[model samples]
Target: MNLEECRKEIDRLDKELTNLLEQRMQVVAKVAAYKKANHMEIFDPRRERQVLDKIAAMAQYKELAPYLQKIYQCIMDESKNYEREYMKL
Candidate 1:
């Protein structure tokens, strides 16, 4: 494939990733709602550790694994913050 075609493919995949992230955010919102109803904490250290451990083991891209872990950490941190704020409502 040409460079332009590859670029277009990457753009399409990026858009799909954006949509998937939004969907994940929606799921996190639902979790926030449940936590609010149950008076549970927004950030669970055990759960976070489980996620990190699983990601660390499961990531196939050795070169990009650290970057991916950083990305997931940021996303989870933001998600927890979002849940904290959302629960206040």
Candidate 2:
């Protein structure tokens, strides 16, 4: 395809990403509730490691692992913030 087509594809992918992010946040809200009820901490190192490992294994390019990890880190940080707010802790 042409440049415009590629750009449009990116736009479409971005829209999908945005939608997924929103859905993930909703799930995070539930997680916050669960954690609050269970007296769990916001930061779980083992879960983070497992998530990163799974994401890295699904990577199409090994070079993208670091970038993907950073992205997930930021996402998880936001989720933690949400959890804190939800639990008022």
Candidate 3:
């Protein structure tokens, strides 16, 4: 494919990613609601570790596996923060 078309594809991919993130946020909001309703903790370190390990296991690049885990950890951290503020518990 041409460079222009490939660039457009990248933009489209980014838009798809943004849409997916919004949907994921909606799910996280629900999780926050449940947590507040049930008096559950917002942060779960074991879950976070599982997430990182899962991502690392799924990574294709050996050198990039840790980076992927780091990025996902950051995303999860922010998501948990959102849950905390949204639930206010």
Candidate 4:
């Protein structure tokens, strides 16, 4: 495909990604509410490790595992931040 076509594809994929991320964040908000009610900490190292490992394992391209892990790490970090802000902690 041409450069313009590639960019358009990327844009299309990005729109889908944005929608999915928004859905995930909505669930994260629910989690934040639950944690706040239970007085639980926002950060769970074990959970984070599990998520990263699962994400890495799910990568279709083995060579992309590291990059996917990094992307997920950032996502988890932002989730924690959102949770903290939501809980006012």
Question: What TM-score would each prediction reach against the true structure?
Answer: 0.84, 0.88, 0.83, 0.97
CA lDDT, every model vs. true structure: 0.90, 0.91, 0.90, 0.96
Q: Write the per-residue lDDT of candidate 3 for residues 1-89, one digit (tens) a residue.
A: 99999999999999998999889889999999999999999998999888888998898887899899888887898899899899874
Over 4 Å off, model 3: 1-6
Highest lDDT against the true fold, candidate: 4
lDDT of 1 by residue, 8-89 (tens): 9999999999999999999999999998899888889999888877888888987777787888999999999889888888
Tens-digit lDDT string for candidate 2 (1-89): 99999999999999999999999999998998898899888899999999988888989999999899889989988988888897885
Tell me the deviation in Å of residue 60 in model 2.
1.5
After TM-score superposition, what is the CA distance of residue 80 in candidate 4 from its true location, in Å? 0.5
Candidate number with the higher lDDT (2 or 4): 4
Q: Looking at model 1, report the run of 10 residues with the lowest lDDT sum.
A: 61-70
62 in model 3: Cα distance from truth in Å? 3.1
Give the clash count for each candidate.
0, 0, 0, 0
